[model samples]
Target: MADLIPPTGRVHWVGVGRATGSGLGLVCDEAATVLWGRTVARAEARLEELGLAGGAEPRALAPGALARELVPGDVVVAMLPAAGHPALAEVALAGEAHLVCPGYAAPGLSPHARRAAERGSVLLTEVGLAPGVDHLFAHDLVGAARAALGDRPAVAHFASHHGSGKDRPDAFRHHFDRAPHEALTALLTPARVIAEGLPRRVARPWEEVRRLTVGGETFEAHPAGDSLPFVTTYGLPATWRLESFARGTLRPSGWNAAWKPVLAELAEADAAGVAALAERLAAVHPAHDADRDRVVMSVRLGVHTDDGTDWAGEWSLDTVGDARESATARLVSVPLACAVLEVAAGRVPPGLHQATDDPEAVRRWLTFLTARGIVATFRGDGAV
Candidate 1:
């Protein structure tokens, strides 16, 4: 079997569902292998599809069983739903397994993070694109702002367009049919480490679709999810005027408007209603099928110095699936693959760490991905 980790250290992989498997399997080749489930037909099919060939067996996600075989669960890659994560995050830390993922915010991350830190095992989340790399980009901007002004700026604006291009809105409805609640209609969701001061603002998802025109192309974004936490992570002052948002990326015109009705109705709809909405939307505005999917991210930061002079900068990244895989899978999974390796190599720290603290890791990931097809760019390099 491909064992990218040491022969003696085995990784217990949980939630080997479709997208997570795609990501977990990529970083693990001959170094450290998944201790269980490799031989299962579905896993085998996935591995075979992803260009990995191994003879490892699939086992249920049991800490005891895994500990017996892999011995002390030193490393784990979890793809369980956000709600299911905290308990497992706790278990993995207790087992001494350094953990990582590309997921959105979860209550579990902060709680178990402390235990992982005391134990010297890392627990990393939001290590993927939007939440992950996007944070890293925020740190860079803050660093630049400080370099220019010698102190934190008085005001900053952060926003993003992070969404999916589904086959049909309900194309993946079967996946969420059972969870009638907790859909995007209910929730919403950046950056950097001065590691001291943070300016924060919170808003519901898509509630305020801030409009913008970039490179002659206009798009919209909105505030969502705990973005205020970043103001602290970046070491901005409480008085620092900060506004940040994360929204779905869209086409130049009418794309967001096209789906606004469905999303508007999301709160009132059950699973069936949501599914019907997606299908109906697809009949007129269909998502790309079989063709590669893509994620386009833009992080724009505006800093107004205490003296009132203003400086602004931006970072843009566009990635699509390779001929071998989907971009959504790659953007979400690949950085996570490298993160697992970081834990294995002792590069990342334990405790609820976000991707922003690891700039070098981010650079390496972006570089490696570029070799495969991801495109990343930085603008207004000097204003930083």
Candidate 2:
């Protein structure tokens, strides 16, 4: 990935659902001047809000509707729920339009990817923040490590730490305060691990807990799928034991010490007990109840030389007003805008493409994000 890919054409959005703080909506709303959204009402409102009109027309997200009129050069952004993305990708592929998403590249999208390549179109996914910028930063780190040390890194760990908004009218509430054990309940869901050439997997979110301190602030971080995918994605050699993941969450401090009980309950499989525990946790990490809340995350990639020497890398971003417009939304959606351009120009050679797999696209796209107001940084113990 060239840092990241740039926009290659006029954008056409596929889903028209309510654009809350969703990445899809942020992309559609922000690129309103250049892109067309499928939902007529939402598109009109978004257009009116952005002070732009009809660069795109509102229509159903149906491919037949799209295929009959939509052809090459159109960009289809799939911001629908996780289950719907695969279908949407297929729709766009059949119509000869490009595809983009902030979501993971699930097994389902594989077929559409194959078809898109056959059709000579781009099928871009995971272009937003965590999955988007996160992968780009990791690839750069991986590439740099190779340049710095003769031996590729063996054991590597990746982690993302951040907090979501408290339950408001619509926002999902993030826990800020809970017993230390309570926090352990998430042992399986968040941190998942994959080692190079290791047939087995290890998941004990609680056991992987490590206290994280940044910016003079301290918090506990339980590994979240930080190291699972990278080893395979990078195809490291047997000597490499790569485990990439993210675990930085937004909280004042002492959050880790408080959530232990929740973890214990999770182990007990107490359904009602879990819900009650969740509510209690929210009470402690209550939303600021104002529109001024924020999300701060730092994704770090730690590396060890094949000789067992050590190094570190990081991309730390603090996004404010997340309740109003979350980092999650922007991270997922903005990449769609770039994918639109790539497909419009026919640069994406289909098949299955990973953002980190293409150095050029990764660099180009990351550069574009800086202009769009995304804060990015490269820090390492040693220079590339």
Candidate 3:
């Protein structure tokens, strides 16, 4: 492990987007916090909206603006798009400050991680919602299976989905920050997954939609990204055989039926046509203030030996938005807040790291999330 820079107890949180929620309050409670937004006024407004008007300082985010205020040992929490992470990371490394983000660890971050380790600064990623809590569940399940079955060969399958809790008759239910069509368009790209003990490419993931039941509710699920890499990340025993594995998005039941027309339109629509369709869909299905969002994630694993000894278990999270905060925002921000605190405490070594797999750290994070009313239930045949 590299020598970690002692934290200064000051945090600079960048961006005040929809995903930014009560988690900010948690960080504010423990650190001298500053909230950065597109403009100083926008940052101030968001603070007021979050009921944290005077809880933290508000600043405008511009090129070099955040870099100017950063100092060694400070923590920078990025709540912006994935594309902006590298730039913010550059700023953090230059200032010898730690950086944290909820997004996946893109390839661009590899070099930053090397530099961060050398500079004694932490760079934590994937500590929110599906990537965050789901990771905890997977690690715990795999650890339990290993203890019980001890490298025995077994078939394993994993899936995660996010859908609206409230039923909507429309084609789409959730609100998006960008063009909704782009999300649909991105689905055209292929994803890689482990299936039948081999890696396979899924050209049209949406075409392979399958029914997934979580917490007694059935929803539509399809793989979203490359999942083969996570087999190593989750520390699965090399001796175990994988039947199926995927990390995917979940949608309400009957999503395919509702999306059929939209998919057909996207197939042949040009750029201009797609933009028009997006505009039309936005108008037809505008989000309502009364709407409530929900997020559900489940990770299940099973192991078996030739003697027929078996171990099966699952950990699932189901949370809905409340008057206080949206479910997506709460789930995403709170775990991220937890990671920031851990980094501040110098528990995480300086370098690039995902949500911790250490048993104690996993327990601590899950317990903290439970106390905040985000609980993941475990149901299995064996003790975990």
Candidate 4:
């Protein structure tokens, strides 16, 4: 029996599920010590697989009890769903433990963030692949553009595209790295994005698709979630001609034609209907443990000055997973894992925040990723 001990200044992984646990397990291998808190058989199986079953402490405890046991200086990595975040964040705040997650911060995260700030604990969210890495690249590019022009550019356009699946197409033409239910649910979720300097609700996101070519392969980019908040977060000048700013999910070519109608139906479906749809989709796109997944990300920033000078910059990352983990999981988890370690080491500032825009921090994080065999490159004139 593992006691719900207070902050020993160690890492605590609060859940062990199929999609997220493998990445968390990789972090466990890197950390000096970790408390593996989970309720599933997969938890034990993963630890044994990682050769840490004998070393890492595994506690099959509930989240509430586990929260009470955390203490100041502790790093709590929540590997659960977004629905469970606010409650767990409240506990981490009370325990004064730094909280990090690969998921987006729920709307209810504000209060928890405020309390965490008062406690001097950092609550960092959106540290995964698409939102996380995309945020970093966007911020860096915007900053660089402003610096080059010696002022905020008169016009700024920002866009990001990222996605993952099998290197080759299958029956469904795509596969999900996460639970099919989660993927299906997200397909219909409405988001507010900025387009031509106006806020718009994108109910059927796949309808707004942009195409791109990476490594000689074509992929379709569709608006995933809102991009307005990030435009502000990146500190792009509102006074500038902010023509367009959007973050989108990337998929193989022809994905838009295939998924558009399917998402339209899901948007009008009830809970039961959604469940049924999820089941059908899952059956067609069941994950294969032996399959190697890939992650492709591209972020672009374009700015124009009245002086007739124009500047455009872009950052791209394309990686494939090895035997240890899926490319999707590794890309999503490693940045988060690095963030957790940095928080525990007293390097990260204390506060509720989204992905960081600090240049040095971004550089350090990217360097870490490059060392892990991730092929990342920045190409732009006078770009940071």
Candidate 5:
């Protein structure tokens, strides 16, 4: 490990998108923060909307503008699209600053991570919602299962789902930078899962949709991304025989039926046609102020030994947005905010980190999240 650069407590938060919620307030309360938006005025407006006016400096996001202001040991919280992260990583590296993002670690960031490790700076990713909170839940469950089952043969299943609220206009919810159609198109990519002790690639994930129940509510679930790597990431013992493993998205029941037409159109449409379709869909289903969102995430693991000892456990989070903040924004940003605070305090080591697998850190983060009103419950059956 490289020597860590002592934090200066100055933070540059880029992007004021939907995921930017009260979490910014958490960062501002702890650091000398600057909120960056497409324009200074837009950033200011968001601060005011977040009731954070005068809480932090506001700036326009001009090319190279943020890099010019960074100093060694400062933190850069990237709330932008995944494509924009590598460039920001470069900026952070050039300034010898630490970087944090709530999205998955892009392959482009690996080189930056190596560089950051050498420079004594940190590059943290996947600390939000599905990738973030879900990871914590998975790690906790795995730790428990390992303690209880040892090297016993076991079967495991994991799923995290975000469903629509009662007031949502349509099945599709636009939470990230991508347009609805574009986001849907990206889902066409194949998903990899370990099933029946064999790795398999799913070319059409939506077609593999299965019904799942979390907290007594049924949802339509399907694989989201490649899950093979997480077997090691989650610290599952290789000696244990595996039955099934997957990481996927969850939607309201009947979601497949509701999205059939749109999926058909997306399957056939070219780029321009997809853009047009997105526009039509947006116009028809414009998100309203009254619109509320809900998120439901569940991670479960089950193990059995030849002696007939059975152990099973599950961790779940189900939250609905209020008039003040959307559930998506709260769940995503709050955990990210906690991560930022952790980095600022020099708790996270330099190099690439994907939400800590350390048991103590996981416990602290869950406590912080629960204190802030985002809570995940756990249930266990049989064994230690």
Candidate 6:
């Protein structure tokens, strides 16, 4: 990717959603202009309301025009649904431009990865908060811990929890900040984790719920999905006594309790029944355009060593946004926009990849985040 980049580039935003809306705004701040594409007029109108539509060239992404709107050396921020990523990857490759998205690349992206390789374009996925910021923080923590431990035999545990909600409390304990469908899917899907030194897949969502308080706000953190893969991604040695590692999502105080009946209904309901439940939830907890919201995330790595020496390293982020902006939007969009600029400037290495945990890149990225109002603190042996 470093070898492929040109001295400058243009940005094209595909899809218009919560994070993508903010992403377009940030991209516009950096670049002179941006191309905004969406399938629906209502979505485009929303962007216009957010003040993102004016400076951007809005276009309708009708059918196959995704590939036709681009040229070489352009950077495409794909905020399309997960199912649409594979085709978008192909479009990016066909246009010979770098691709950046907040989600993981689908299986259909493999062939396009090769094509991107030949064209010197890159596919960057999983570049959002959890998979993005948390990954970087985990890498830094593990690396720092390893350096401090030296030759000591150690045991390690890692965890990351994140969620967002309105500032004013609500019965549901959460709002549809992003696409309601995505939240619905997260609520219904089973989570995977490493438990008792083995991979444990939970058949239900919101299991093993626990309380978490950060920056004076409290939330319910639920077991999300497998985090063992990050053990290697963070460069923890297999020889270390790795006891447990997991990543989970967080919600406001009464989120799990409020959604319990909804989950129960979804499990036993038919297709139509599921849709009805989803509609009810969305109607009741619609995202408020004028409400302030908060985003909190914590990443901790604990190491147990010989001779009873024990300690842990921790990093956390807590922030709130007002009616005109949001913590969720800024955290998700800024990093992605910065990444696209990095790729354009020849900072990212070539080939297909997800969110990178490279220490240098992470430090730079974190610095950028801090500049953009998302401050994170890190502690080694003591509090920051």
Q: Is 2 or 4 the stronger prediction by TM-score? A: 4
Runs of candidate 5 with Cα error greater than 4 angstroms are: 163-178, 382-384
Cα lDDT tens digits, model 6, 70-140, are 77878887787778887777777777778887876546565676667766888887778866888778878
Identify the runs in model 4 with alpha carbons over 4 angstroms from their true place: 1-8, 19-32, 40-42, 260-270, 382-384
TM-score of each: 0.77, 0.74, 0.94, 0.89, 0.93, 0.88
The Cα local distance difference test for each model comes to 0.57, 0.56, 0.83, 0.73, 0.84, 0.74
Q: Per-residue lDDT tens digits of candidate 2, residues 95-195?
A: 66667776678666876655666666667776656566667776766666666654654776655565543323222224342242344344545544543
Q: Worst ten-residue run, lDDT, model 6? A: 1-10
- Clashes in each model (backbone N, CA, C under 3 Å)? 29, 68, 2, 1, 0, 3
Off by over 4 Å in 2: 1-10, 16-39, 49-55, 60-64, 152-191, 194-204, 235-252, 260-262, 270-289, 304-310, 322-324, 382-384
What is the full ranking by lDDT, best candidate first?
A: 5, 3, 6, 4, 1, 2
Off by over 4 Å in 1: 1-9, 21-26, 35-39, 55-64, 166-207, 214-216, 237-240, 243-252, 267-289, 356-372, 381-384
lDDT by residue for model 1 over 309-337, one digit each (tens)? 77777777766555676667777776777
Better of 2 and 5 by TM-score: 5
Candidate whose TM-score is highest: 3
Ranking by TM-score: 3, 5, 4, 6, 1, 2
The runs of at least 3 residues in candidate 3 whose Cα sits more than 4 Å from the true structure, single-residue gaps closed, are 164-178, 270-273, 382-384
lDDT tens digits, residue span 226-326, model 3: 88888888998877778787888888878788888887887778888878878887777666677677777878887776568888898987778877788
Candidate 6 local Cα displacement, residue 184, angstroms: 3.4
- Which is superior by lDDT, 2 or 3? 3
Candidate 6: segments with Cα more than 4 A from true spot:
1-8, 39-54, 63-66, 108-111, 177-181, 382-384
- Selected candidate, larger TM-score, 2 vs 3: 3
Residue 292 C-alpha lDDT in model 3: 74
RMSD of each predicted structure: 6.1, 6.0, 2.0, 4.2, 2.4, 2.9
